[model samples]
Target: MSQELGITVKKDQNPSEWYTQVVQKAEMADYAPVKGCMIIKPYGMKIWESIKEDFNTKIENTGAENAYFPLFIPESYLEKEEDIVEGFDPEVAWVTHGGDKELEERLAVRPTSESIIAPYMADEVRSHRDLPLRLNQWANVVRWEATDTRPFLRTREFLWQEGHTAHATEEGADEETMLRLEQYQEVIEDHLAIPSILGYKPEHDKFPGAKYTTTIETLMPDGKSIQSGTSHQLGQHFAEAFEIEFEDEDSETQTAWTTSWGLSTRTIGALIMAHGDDDGLRLPPRVAPTQVVVVPIYQEDNRDEVVEYAEEVTEELEEKGLRVDLDDRDHRTPGYKFNEWELKGVPLRVEIGPNEVEDNAVTPVRRDNGEKKMGQDREEFVEEAEEVLENIQESLYNELEEYLQENIREAESKNEILATIGKNRGYVKTRWCGKESCEEEIKDEVSAEIVVLPFEEDSKPATIQEKEDHIDGECAVCGEKAERWAYFAKNY
Candidate 1:
């Protein structure tokens, strides 16, 4: 491949340019005519489909049913929840005129479906038996973002699954919230091969009408924190706003506690940035569209023989329950096919050439570490290839785990925290006095906000009591007895 055709810029030297080239050259996605919209090509869409299938099965097993809601929300309905309305107003895209005529009331394209779904949920649910309504939808949402329009990351239009649930009690709602977050962790770690830190969002950073928000955060290759997923406890806030109540066992009307959680295309962006290398995208095996690509290597004389061997290998692998593909395109050279599949991030590649056919073996190449080895026999090759893919998945997770640990630093003083933020691009773990003023002061100074408080409450040191920390002798910013340690970072 020519330099212009493949990635011209090195990831370490110019990551932004390198990323743009990979996305385009690999046939993953392209910028649309609109400013902040992207067209996900077949290759990218296939990868997304794989991810969706994995999560869909897991979600269905958890007793959640798929459902769809209207795309438009009337202004009056949106205004039901004060916090949600205020939080989303700036980003909501309004549909005012209907063709040449002005509508009686303007409608808003949903930035989220909370307001639109709550009313219908209230209407559909009438009794205590219908208390825990767990429904999810995979759809597109529009938000008029003012800046940052990277494809799959900060686009104005993005695809995602928004899950809305109503519970009988506050404790039930809270449990559901954490359960969803745990599911997110499983998907991220097992399928995406990305490690994440589970924690609670700071009050100032919690999701808009949620009583509290729990999140799973992952560190990208650039040391920036990406919120992989979030689950919110809506606490009767929207229940009262929308008056979603059910007749209880006692025959008394009681408000339902609600929760909403989502994972978006942004996770795709994170997967690219986290595992992708200077060569190209490195997708985990569980979610790779073509887990193993078979490349046939042949010269003019042995072309048919080599191609036949490649087909046999593909069939064998497929029978073993692997997603296998045979690259039998005659026009392209075997070297060219290898480069293409590498750029597309196939987990493993099987090369069957004339020499390999004579030896009754195949050469296997691993994308993760670029390791090449000879397979003893057809069965051995298939088993080894499967093992290599599993290893790559675990290797990617281990690499990211180390990166996350290195990016987080413990800061004991205000100046130290500021200095750490300036030098490193990730979270700075420091003690806070539980004061808004102190949080705001740090934010103003370093442009960093508190992102999460880890879920392990007892894991906190003895020096910290009821959010009070005696270690630093004072809050990082306020000079008061520090209450608790929290992770602060500049977020996406």
Candidate 2:
């Protein structure tokens, strides 16, 4: 393929540049006029719509409802929650004036919606019968990320869904937090086809004012970990801040428990790094915008006949409920169309020519592994196409699963921790004292921090306590007593 029309760098050699090329060449997105924002093209928007539609189904089953909220939040609302203001102060963008008039109070561009949404929840949740209230908003949020700005990964303005919920008790809040994390894992793994590790963020790294935060973390081909999704158990912190009180069955007033969870377009960056190759993106069939492209091959002599038959095959696949496209452009050669579809990561391609039209057959090629089946009878290929798509999904996931398994390693000393991250840059499980100072030491030296303190082998309701109880070793940094496992890595 020519450099101008295709990926110019190998993914393994220059991943940062390779990623940018694939995203633009595939027509997924483009950089906006704003420094740290991106314009989502139609092809990129379709992937996000698939994620949104799929997540809506899973969350709606748990009594969650979608709602809209204002983009601007007042300064008083943020000050009401001390942690919200403190945690996001450096990143928060404020509007000081309107038109030519100085505003009485500043408005925050909403680094997050906790301060604004909590007050709304307090107004609605006033009784035990009004418990387990869940509200989700699909919106854009802006943070002033002045350095290391990249498309989708760390953009200043991006789209996401933040779910704010109120419950009667802490147990209900915990259940809600873990449930959302589970649903996010399904979307990331089953749809995006990436492997993940679900665990707790160390206390210092947890969301500000949260009782605790659970995260779904995934690794990239470059060995850096990505925080794909996060579910925070806010407990009574937000409830008390906003005065979300309720009357219990015993006629006693009690403070409600609250939780917040979110998954963003950053996961799309994970999808690109996990499955893309030098050729370009390798989207799984489940979420691919165009699952199959039917490319017709013919010379001018028999172009009409070949083009007509290719349409029949396309319609057949469409009848089988597949997203099919017939690339019968007269000006483009079959070779050019193949490279285009492959760059866009269509999971499968069907090629037809005069030979197949006369034989009443079709040839199917797999995008995941480039395996081509020759001249299958047309009647049998419809169901076979579905089977091929299913296999491509599995193969893409398995490739990442194997890579993740191979990259996670164990470290028991400070030098070992630094050495491991310096050389490999993947997850390094180390015996930790649960002290931020030790993490700071490694981070200062190598720029790697604790990404996760894994949950116990069998414990589920988002427990780091059980995990804490099981570890017995000296601190990797201080060599004092240690009681936890911390997975350290350089993250994006």
Candidate 3:
């Protein structure tokens, strides 16, 4: 493909520019007139819907019910949770008037629905029976950011699902938090085909008003980490602020313990950065909008036969439950069609020609690593396509796994940590004292922060105490006894 028609920058040389060109060239999104927002095109929206559908099923199965909250939150409501208000003050977009008239109480466009949803949950939950009340909303939130704009990565308004739940005990809330985090891990690994590190966010970086935050972080090709998803243990903080109390079994009034978690459109950004290349996006089979495209190669003399056979093959693949597209536009050359599908990052492509029609076979090409296979008979081709799609999914994930394994290195001291990060863009594993001061010191050196305190393998159920346990060695920066071995990376 030529520079004018396809992405001109290499993925490694200039990921930022390459990403912008790929997203636009592939028709996933377009820049909006608004400075910090983007318009999600049909292809991008399809991928997002696929993500939503998979995650919604997981959330519902966990006993959470979907609900909606108002987009505009009253100013006073934010004050109820002082930390939340302070944390979002800069990004909170205010709606000051109705048409031309000044409003009595200025409203803040929802940066997040916590303040609004917490009070509603307080009103609905009354007794122990309502103690574990769980509610979630699939909606858009506006956070007026002042950073450099990227399409799905960071925007003024983005789509996401915010889940809020109230429980009778800290144990219940803790369970709720980890459960959601695990579900996010499953989605990222199983569906999106991206490997991630799951653990706790350091104290200074925990979500505002949260007792602690748990996160699923994935490393992008740029040597930066993107927090793919996060689950927070609010621990009665919001419940106390909003008075979300319930009567216990003994009939005594008590405040509820609460937790909130979210997976956003940012995950789409992670997918693109993790697997996209100089050609364009390399979508996983599960989330790819058009997983397979059938292109027919024909001339006027054999166009009828070639086109007819291609349609038949398309029907056969469709019946097998694949997202198949038949690219039979009469004017486009086979080479052009191939480039278009590749640029769009379809996982598999099938080529049908007059020769293949006479031979009752079809050839398939894999996108993850351009490995083409010889033609197979029509009935056998269906099974081969299924296997190739599965292999592509596995291959993509394995490639990421290998990249992570090769990139994550142990650093013995603070200087080592700084040197390693400066030299390579990946995770640097090192011991830390678990102090915010020490973390800041390291950040000053390499601009990398503690991304996660990785979960340990043990027979006991994963808990905060276990996640916080120190792994080995002295603090990399402080020279004090280490609290834990943390994964540190410069984040996106």
Candidate 4:
């Protein structure tokens, strides 16, 4: 492959440039006309669609239905919830004029749909019979962040699915929040093949106005963390603000407990960083848009025979329920097709040359590690292709899981925390005092903040700190009594 067609920079040596080259060269996404924005191409959207389909199934199974909400939110609605509005103040984009006339009330683009969705839930929920109001929407939101823009990772406008639900009790809200968070873990780790640290954010750093926020943070190869997904237990905050009062069986009116969770297109960015190499992207087969691409190698003389045999192989894989692509483009050489498919990160490639066409067999190559299986009987190869795809998916995930496990190191002192994460650039598990001042000390010194306060095994976020069994050791930063188990890291 030429310099322009293939990745020109090594992934570790120049991660930023390597990412840009792969994103555009492999047809994932392109920079939009506006800075801080990107147009996700068909290839990139394919990955998001896979994420959506998987999560949608899990959500719908729990009685949540998909719904649509407006993009423009009235300023009055946002003001109803002071914490949420204040939380997004700097990034909120407002509209003062409508077409030609000046509007009486300003319109704020939806940084998130909590303000709008809460009111809608208020209208639909009236009594205990209408409890557990669950709704979600797949849409785009705008936040006018002026700096540090990148495609998918931190775009000004991006696509996501936000889930909003109302319940009669805090217990119901807790169950709902943990439920969605687990589903997000499945979507990220089980399907996307990216492992992450699961925990709740520190109180000072939880989502604004939320009772608590559960999150999944994944480490990138470049030593930055990705806030991949979040689930928030809203606990009567939005319900009180939006007047979502439902009547109980005893005829008492009460505010509903609410919860919200979201997973965004940024997962596409995570996929690129977690698995790509100097050659190009290396997709896990579970969510790869095209699992297998069969390239027919032939000359002008034997084109028909070779191409026909390749089609048979493609049909066999398709019959076995694989997303197979037959590269029968007459103009492009077999080598060119191989490079292009490899750049696109197709997990498995079958090179059907003249020799294999004559042998009534196929030669298979693994994209993850470039391993080859030569001269396997055609029927046997087709029968075993599904197993190969499964193994590739598992192998890719295990590689990342091991990397994440190896990098999570424990630290006891403030200097140790700074030196370890500053040089190593992964997670530092330490005891925190739960004070913003102590957190700021580290943030000011080396830019690593408390990313998570994890819950112990078989523990609940709401009651984890209240448990008496866990000990409160000295804080790593101030040497005061520690209050939480925290993971500190630099993030994107």
Candidate 5:
């Protein structure tokens, strides 16, 4: 645990540098030869596996089946829906040749599986019985990005689960959209221990071809906003484009309503930014690859006894359903092991020394607060470890909750909104006559745009008279009456 091998920069001072150091030094991930791509190391991959298992279980319980789709899409298929193609065209990576032979129709590496999946759905779905087709795929996608490639944040290729569903009616599609978003919120907030804001993206910010997009936005420590997850209501756009029609009970053919939602490796970036500290990554207990690490402190006199006791404790903790690891390599010093585990950000550390062994108690240290508490009976220690992990999760969430509240400000005027965004580095809650022009104007003027238009539009506070008045006020940029209040921010 030398300074050179650990994070040297403070997060508050140089967050970008600090993050880079942590990711590499902690052996989480490594930069690949290709720019904008990273190799997920064993530790990093383990965390992702844990997250995937949890989400897979949740979706499976809700009747979603996992499936695989082609990784390449024909250019013509993508162009089936004009809006989707236009939105993704600039970012797509196309394969013009196959093994050196020129190809007639260029295939695009899947930026998303929508176009490829849609046409297949059209072929497979023929009647109302196949209406609610819920298919999810865990796959890799390529999006050719131009700038700022942070390991998990912005990358050329990344792993994610994209869930695509087709329903018989608009109401059913809407319900599916919200239900998936709710599940995402639960997995992120409760399991990942990250607090998030649920809202709808503005028309301009919605997914390329979606009728409307719902998202969960979480605030990072640096005050930037990270979109944790998103669910889109596809209306009849893709259904019509792909000719996915169903014969209803009434005997008429109608386009099926569709929805697609995704959660990506970027969520890992959010977790790092949200809860990590100078010590290193602070993973939530439920998702931590190693929830607890037992360091056996030994001396020549009691080395054997201390190591044996540590193994027993590790076995007991494992039996109690904890991911426990006993560090008995006999090579590293106790002090060194502590630093390594802290840098790796294990939620709890148990130090077993001769004194603790004699006293029948162990020393417990919490990663979040670095608080040391004397253990009790072995059974009690296991129970308290469980409680401590939960406490850490809650405390980490509350810390971010306070940050979100403090960073968000209610702005009354365009100038106020700009100033708030510039100074606070967070979102500005303001009244926007729901006009696309107003959103454009704000973007042009201050480079900040509407991120989310809350679903609970009518529940805005009464004190915001300007917002209420502008409910139909002329567009902030043009002269059209506003349609809704929006959360505006400069996004990553």
Candidate 6:
């Protein structure tokens, strides 16, 4: 492969450059004309489609129906929720004119749908029958962030599904919050093959106006942490602010509890950074756009025979319900095709050379680790490919799982926390006093903050701090009596 065509930088040496090279060289995405935005090319969009489809099914199963909301929201709507508006005010993009004329009331592009969705829920929800007003919208939002711009990671405009649900009781809202969070865990860990830490964001970092926020945080190969997904228990904040009152079982009007959860295009960035290598991307089979690619190796003399055999193998894999592509382009050489497919992170590649054609078999290559199985019977190869794909997926996730387990250092003091994070570039688990001032001071010093306070086994986030039976230690920063265990990390 040419230096310009293949990844130019080694992943371990320079992850940032390697990522940019893979995303662009492999034709996944390209930088848009505008700053802080990217054009998600076909390859990148396909991966996002996989994430959308998986999460959509899970959301719909929970009785949340898909709906569309306006892209431009009235400024007054956001003002209703002071915290939500304040949190996003710095990044909000405002529109003051309509084509040529100045508008009386300037509108704000939706950074998040809470302000708009909350009002709609307030109007639609009138009775107990509408207790669980579940609605989700797959849409694009704009946030005018001007720092660390990267494709899919910190984009100005990105696609995501924001779920807005209102429940009659706080318990119901809590259940809904945790339910969506667990589903996000499944999407990230099971389908994307990226292991993650599931927990509640510290009080200081919880989503604006949320009672608490649950998140799945994953570590990148470069040591920075990516917030893979988030679920927020909105409590009665939005509902009360928006006047989302409903008649209950006793016919009394009460404020409804609301929850909002979102998993965005950022997951695509996490997937690329998590599993990709120096060769290029190494997509997990389940979410890879093309699970298998058949490359026919042949000379001018045996071209017809080898190409036909590659098609036969492709058809066999397709018949077995695999997403297979037969690269029969006449101009590109077999070696070129292999590099292209490998760069695109096709999970499995079948090389149907002259020798394999004569043996009535194909050599299946695993993209994850470059393991090859030679001379397997054609019919048996399809069955074997299924097992191979599963193994590849499992291996990708296990590698990250082991990394996560090994790198989470337990710190007993402030210096230990700083040293651990500085040296290892991963999470430092420590006892925090649950004080915002202490957290602020620590952030000023180490540039790392409490990312999440993990729930104890069979414990809820609301009650975990109160239980106090599991851990007993002083605050790592202030030496105050510690409340619970939390993981701190430098983040993306």
lDDT of candidates 1 onward, in order: 0.85, 0.91, 0.90, 0.90, 0.86, 0.89
Estimate the overall C-alpha local distance difference test score of candidate 3. Answer: 0.90
Q: Give the per-residue lDDT digits (tens) of candidate 4, residues 244-305.
A: 99999999998999999999999999999999998899999989999999998889999999
Cα lDDT for residue 109, candidate 4: 92
Candidate 6 lDDT over residue span 301-410, tens digit each: 99999998888888888888999999988898888888888899999999889999998988888999998889878888887788889999999999999988888889
Best by lDDT: 2
**Residue 332 of candidate 6: its Cα lDDT?**
89
Candidate 5 lDDT by residue in tens digits, 1-492 = 677667899998999999998888778889999999999999999988988998999999997999999988999989999997899999999999989999999999999988989888999899999979999999999999999999998899999999999999888888888889989989899988888888887767789988888899988888788898999998899999999999999889989999999999999888888889998888889889999999988888899999999899999889888899999977888888888888888999999998888888888899999888875566678777787888988988888888888888888777777788778878888767766777777788777878776656455322122334445444444445566768888776
- Tell me the spans in candidate 1 whose CA falls farther than 4 Å from its real position: 457-473
**Model 2 lDDT tens row, 184-254:** 99999999999999999999999999989999999999999999999999989989999999999998999
* lDDT value, candidate 1, whole model: 0.85
Model 2 TM-score relative to the real fold: 0.98
Among all windows of 10 consecutive residues in model 1, the one with the lowest summed lDDT is 460-469
Compose the digit string of candidate 1's lDDT tens values, residues 187-231: 899999998988877777788988888899988777677888899
Off by over 4 Å in 4: 458-469
Runs with alpha carbons beyond 4 Å of true place in candidate 6: 458-470
Error of 4 at 71 (Å): 0.6
Q: Could you give the candidate ranking by lDDT, starting with the highest?
A: 2, 4, 3, 6, 5, 1
C-alpha root-mean-square deviation, each candidate: 2.6, 1.1, 1.3, 1.3, 3.2, 1.4
For model 3, what is the error of residue 207's alpha carbon versus the real structure, in angstroms, after optimal superposition? 0.8
